[model samples]
Target: MSALTKQSAEEWTQLFDERYKRTAWPYGSAVWGKKEWVCPDLRNESVVSMDEGGSNLFWAERFGRELGMNDLWVKLCGNSHTGSFKDLGMTVLVSVVRQIIADGGTIRAVACASTGDTSASLAAYAAAGGIPAIVLLPRGKVSTAQLLQPIANGALVLALDTDFDGCMAVVQRLSLDEGIYLANSMNSLRLEGQKTVAIEIVQQLDWNVPDVVIIPGGNLGNVSALGAGFEMMASLGLIKKQPQIVVAQAEAANPLFRAYQRDWHFEPIEANPTQASAIQIGNPVSVRKAIRTLERHQGIVEQASESELADAAARADRTGMYNCPHTGVALAALIKLRKRGLIDARSRVVVVSTASGLKFTDFKLGYHEQRLPEVNALHTNAPVELPNDYDSVRRAIDTHSGWNP
Candidate 1:
């Protein structure tokens, strides 16, 4: 474990050059690209993966133009096997569990408390590796699509009556048993996998680091993971600079944002329900790691209200990107930062889309139908009813779309 932390710039660079150039998958996986840096002790056969990572670092030219930033990009982490960035971390966590079992460790099942994505990813990877998994979820909190992932993967899903924090506490206590292992972001192994997003971003940009990177914050693990990735890159001579990171949060559940507002005097909050359900974590387990990341990287924490996040997601969808509400939080934060002059319109930026928009169809439908409470649908493209006639259809199209015939 110390080897991962104590690796010098020269040693890291050597490993990067050797493995990063591989054409085969798993080796080509950004998380495993520098396998020596990630899980070096595991043999090829011991590795369990769905070829996660290598997600598209898409150039959001239209959306960038709208924001007056020509170099804006979206790291589409939603494109993973589990349809969320959680797959990146879960692959690593579950892989390590498999390696441990192979090495004579006695673990019967892996368990985690999830908002949605974590359990989905964990269950899928554990199933792939022939490992049984137990998932704890906040009852009626997670999206239907998210809840289905773990269930479909054959995990023992337990829907706790309390919120995610309660679920976390239960899972943590359950993992105390020697037969079960915890697969949460608190585990440093997951950070090693999540950090590869940073490596992949720089790699996709031909080794040119971006000026700013914004990611949604719930657990705060990703913030620290990204920071760790950049630190490792700089330490390994891969890059000369680190990006100014922004951890975007939903105002309804923004403990880290509130901490930043108080000049780093941190206090956890009782997170309220929000449309960005995936990040509705009040007391994040990785708050300390996130704070350390902020201190080291000159980080910024920004919060987006429900309406702002909804509007931002809708606006981004118009530009050909179907964004999850969590991604909306990051985009809203980007807008807020731009207004505050923290992020210049001219700077190259990347906003991480944590999960697929398809997972939140109900939220999207409610927004377009003007049904969600407290959210003003500023750009609704609602379907107009029409009679089944050419004239009626033409008139509805002309009226709704504002195109004169």
Candidate 2:
């Protein structure tokens, strides 16, 4: 369902703003875009996000004063049903799954590999939708909030003694299992839902599009899907200009950076070490798509160092953005590119903050700028107001955070 299928512009506009507020959604069976939407076959396969009002405010360039739609406008894909941009994909996938079940399908479960947000979205949805969800989380990777979703939603949460790659291995194995469905990037239905971000972005801009879109690269599905969205938008006459896309990655695992530099195929990486754990992927599932999309639209890939990411994370905190290390990496990359004159200052830039920093509840994005405390003084609750002499401070110290051990 797309704009052309609409009886009037007003009706299409209403559907475009569905994420802006909750109301009786009547466009369930109607086609609103150039693609067929899908959701899990639960009680109703038509459920969608009821976006609060003012998503339009974000769409409008408050960064500008006149309120006129410039050549570009920012789209907060993060405003999806699940809080993170994954909702854009999950909503549609849920609908599709529900619909398939209604048709006497034998689908038994859904599974995915998540750094944090995607697993939560799937768990919450599958739990609410009465579908069994199997979430494979990397060992010692995600935060408590990230890990809580599956347990809270009553899904089978498997703490893989592995990283995202290992979890992905399990997902691929499950996908091969009879009656098991993998919800990872392998499912194309999610992309249909994700395409709405671009569609709505153009609609919000009053149809003005960007010259470039920057994404924090991990599995790289979103970045690749973004290019797909723009191409479809162009075909549907949703936007006027095609934006060159750019990807940001941690220098610790600069596979994309290396690939771009050598003008060769992006080989799988072996080890990626960065504070930006969310985007720490040695082998992204959608690299081919990412490469193809970049070729079609002429995008660039860049890397950001850990120190730079930490500094930017602190800067975001200072500016009230309070982003996670993933976003920090993107911001750092952008700043570096700007300093190097790689990104034109006048070019409209959109950086995707995939997950919130608060998701990490315990871990922090930025590092200490000053010299770190000594081994005996790392406790947060340890007293630092001791006498000037280091010996006096040691003598006056209480137990470590009240831990007798």
Candidate 3:
């Protein structure tokens, strides 16, 4: 740590950029590319990586035009091995566990309670490291794709008849047993990798900071991790300005947003079910860390209704972007903030897309079919059925396209 502080910001930037360009074993992986900043003491062979991080920071040209903004972007963190931002953190957690075990520590298995993405990421990384993994999930809450990933990876998945908070309780208890190591975000090792997203965002933008960064919050660890990245950069003189951090939440499960409304007084609620299942957490373990980070940066917490999020996602999907429900929450918040004039038209803004839309096919199908509860389905597009005739097909196509004969 002291060695890193001795180097100037420009030196660190050059080093990171050079490492990013290399195709070496661990340097090719973004997390390990910044190993000195991440897990400095861990041996190179002990690291577990899947080339996580370095996700695309896409320019939302058409979407920005629709939002009346000229400088809007979406950081697609889901474009990774496990198809979510969780891959970034899980790599670090599992690598540290592998290192501990290799050093003669008696860790028999790694365990976590997840709504979906976390379990999938942990399972995949643990499997990659040849370590046993156990995941506790809230029964009937997670998407089918999310559940299948852990199962396919051979993780001991327990579907408890409870919500995410309940499952978290059980996992916490299991971690008390000496043999089972906890792999949740509450473990700071996860944040070491997750924080790399912030660095990557700045790096992708040529070391320029945006005016605002909005991320969908559930467990709240990611937001804090985001802050940690910026804080580290600032401490090292990499950046002089800090962007306003915004946290978007599903209104049904918005404990943080509620706390923000109440002058930062926090209280856990019984989280109601929402389509953004990955963020369906009510009592987030990192709430204190999140609040502290938010207090440091000029932070705001906003929430989206089910209708708002679904409509926002479908609306953005029209612009060639596939968004998960969690991303929809952030998009909806952006729309609201834009409408309220809190966000300027010329300000550069980036919305963090937490998970892949492919993982939530059911949500997409439910929206288009107009089946999801509380969603208005304003942008729903259903397939048109035509008879097996050329004239009939032509007529249907003409009608749909509003073509004149």
Per-model TM-score, in order, reads 0.94, 0.79, 0.98
List pairs with backbone clashes in candidate 1: none
Best of the candidates, lDDT: 3
Ranking by TM-score: 3, 1, 2
Q: What is the C-alpha local distance difference test score of candidate 2?
A: 0.64
Say which candidate scores most in TM-score.
3
Each model's lDDT comes to 0.89, 0.64, 0.94
lDDT of 2 by residue, 255-352 (tens): 78788898846788864556677677788888887888888878888887766776665554443455677776776776777778776756766666
lDDT of 3 by residue, 1-405 (tens): 568899999999998898883689798788888888988988889988888888899999999999899999999999999999999899999999999999999999999999999999999999999999999999999999999999999999999999999999999999999999999999999999999999999998999999999999999999999999998899899999999999999999999999999989999998999999999999999999999999988899999999999999999998999999999999999999999999999999999999999999999999999999998898888777767899988878767852211
lDDT of 3 at 42: 86
- Segments of candidate 1 deviating more than 4 angstroms: 1-25, 402-405
Global local distance difference test of model 3:
0.94
For model 2, what is the alpha-carbon lDDT of residue 210?
64
In the order shown, what is each candidate's alpha-carbon RMSD? 2.6, 7.6, 1.7
Could you tell which candidate, 1 or 2, scores higher by lDDT?
1
